[model samples]
Target: MKEEIQQQISDALGQLFDAVSKLQLAYPGKPFTPDGRLVGDIGEVIASLNYRITLNEGLTKHHDAVADDGRLVQIKTTFSDHLTFPVHHVPDYYIGIRLQADGSFEEIYNGPGQLIFDQLVNRKPTRTGLHGGLMSMLKRINKDVPDAERIPQR
Candidate 1:
């Protein structure tokens, strides 16, 4: 089932990108990169399948999903090389996924949200009150997490 869904997503993305490319060719100086809600929605659905999370209902604050163990999880998805953290509340767990142009993804972080919080707490928040953390930092934090602490992936 997971594989089937993934393949479907891939096909859909392929079509979307093709259309974007055509638009780009028609208007050479314009940027056609898709971001914001669309990318976030894709990340949430895919992360739920990968980590066995139950997604929250529309646009919930702070956390997006709940782990089987009842932990509140903040799911972050990006095509860029970094993940952003909201300075308001620290989630029980955090999962960062980087979506590739090919519709594949890489888990950049999966562990206690405190690790990310601790790193960002001292940093200056942006105008949106979100702190950005680079992939290198996320990978480093992820490596230090013990297997026992990670939410098991499906």
Candidate 2:
């Protein structure tokens, strides 16, 4: 059940990524990559206010991203039904990507690309869900900031 849901999410997010890439390609000067630090979503959102964003692959490995604006973005992703944020210090920004069987993928930009997912059931999705999860994670990193104070202040 969980796997299925994950696949659905991955497919949807992949669609979203393609669309984002196309939009950026049309404009140029903007680069987009995937599978990057989920923490960079913040920088991506803030930077998107001006320069074009590329979906680089660094969005998943870490919790950080670099923006043309010279700012850092830290993105966080979750599959909570209530869309409630964690109380303790968490990622600078949060994104909730619901898993649906629909063929449509929507970015549904909230403030600074921050959004809370609502009413989603837990199910096993196909491998496609991995991709969607990947995008979600990357988006989170893009939104998150490199705060050593919270993670490892070392």
Best by lDDT: 1
What's the distance in Å from true for residue 18, model 1? Answer: 1.1
Across 3-38, the per-residue lDDT of candidate 1 in tens digits comes to: 899898889888988998999999999978877889
- The local distance difference test score of model 2 is 0.36
**lDDT of candidate 2 over 50-122, digit per residue (tens):** 2223334544532234343433334333322212232222333332332222322223122232222221123
Candidate 1 collision pairs: none
- The best candidate by TM-score is 1
**Cα RMSD for candidates in order:** 1.4, 15.9
Worst 10 residues of 1 by lDDT: 125-134
Candidate 1 structure lDDT: 0.87
